[model samples]
Target: MTFEKQVVLVSGAGRGLGAAIARAFIENGAQVVVNYRRSEAQAKALVEELGQRAVAIQADVSDPLEARRLVNDAAEAFGHHVTTVVNNALGDFSFNGDAREKIQTIGWDDFLGQMDVALHGSLNLIQAAAPAMEAAGWGRIINIGTNLFQNPVVPYHDYTAAKAALLSLTRTAAGDLGPSGITVNMVSGGLLRVTDASAATPEAIFELIAQSTPLRRVTTPAEFADAVLFFASPWSRAVTGQNLVVDGGLVRD
Candidate 1:
């Protein structure tokens, strides 16, 4: 349950759920690599706030070359191989139901756009970090997923489909990397209370979702981040290829 010796990398750690995950790892004693694509100011601010234990690195994880560079730079910055990776980076998206693209209107490009960041991005990071992890005889790869594919609460076709594919990758990769001591898993969450991507969601929708969950509340980024910590911690060493839903019990499987 301790991360004192772990060097962790969290993609899109400049803000929202990614940032919260970075903070959680830092609090738990892990040296964190705050990976961001465009939020330079926010990322640097976070690194400064987290002090020496955290360093911000920019890379668009969908590209294999950039992804590899991110992993290499992270190790160089922290003087340790990255022992854990949180694939929380996301393509530009918003959670407005009314503004969503319906099945009839959504094009293939829409789905590809989301997949570029969710599925391909995760694959790139995993491939880049796996060798070091194998050499070290241990690694944790946690992919950020969505409850929408399971519940289809709002039927976000593009985003949900991409996450569903990511869940598949998690399982298959887990099986492939198991012998090398690298565990791959997923953490799926419902419409988070207020991430930049979820900000467009109306308050009424949030209230409705909260009322449906057993906890009678929307899950916060920090609360969901705690579950990510579990997957990265020693307690989950025996667990892999599993998807843990942290949406306040809205979608039970």
Candidate 2:
């Protein structure tokens, strides 16, 4: 239950679930590198609040070069190879059902955009961090995912498809990196109650979701983020290639 001395790199950690995850890791005694693509102000504020244990680095995980530089910069700044990576960066997206494009109307480009960020971005970070992780002989890679691919209550075609693909990569990466003591897993959550991305959702929709879920309330970023810590901690040393859903028992996987 302790990250003690572990250096964690949390992508898109400037705000929302990513920010909550970063804070949780820092609170648990890990030095965290908060990576952000455009949320520089928020990231800097988070780093300031977390003190010297945290540093904010700007990087678009979808770009291989930026991803490499991010890992390199984190190692240089922390004076240690990053021991844990949280691939939580997401492209521009919102949960407003009214605004989402229907499958028939959405072109391949829409799906590709999500893939570029969720799947390819994860691949980029994994590749950049692999060498250092291998050298250390112990590492954790946690991919943030969504339960929508399973339930698809709103049928967000592009977003769900992208996360589904990420799940595949999580398994494949785990298979390849297991021998090196590097475990890859996914933490999937249902519609989070509050996040910048989910802010546009209507209040009525939230109430409906809360009534249907077993917990009687939608999950929060902080609640869902705790699962990420379990994967990174020693308690899950033997766990890998698994997806843990954190959706107030809404969707059982």
| lDDT leader | 1
- What TM-score does each of the candidates earn? 0.98, 0.98
Each model's C-alpha lDDT?
Answer: 0.94, 0.93
User: Candidate 2 — what's its lDDT?
Assistant: 0.93
Question: Given candidate 2, what's the lDDT at residue 53?
Answer: 93
Query: What is the per-residue lDDT of model 1 for residues 1-253, given as tens digits with 9 covering 90 to 100?
Result: 3599999999989999999999999998999999999999999999999989999999999999999999999999988889999999999998998998888899999899999999999999999999999998899999999988889978589999999999999999999999999999999999897889899999999999999999999999999999999999989999999999999999998
**What are the per-residue Cα lDDT tens digits for candidate 2 across 42-144?**
9999999999999999999999999999999999998999899999999899999889988779889989999999999999999999999998788999999
Report how far residue 238 has shifted in candidate 1, in Å: 0.7
Model 1 local distance difference test score: 0.94
Residue 59's lDDT within candidate 2 is 92
Candidate 1 RMSD to the real structure? 0.8
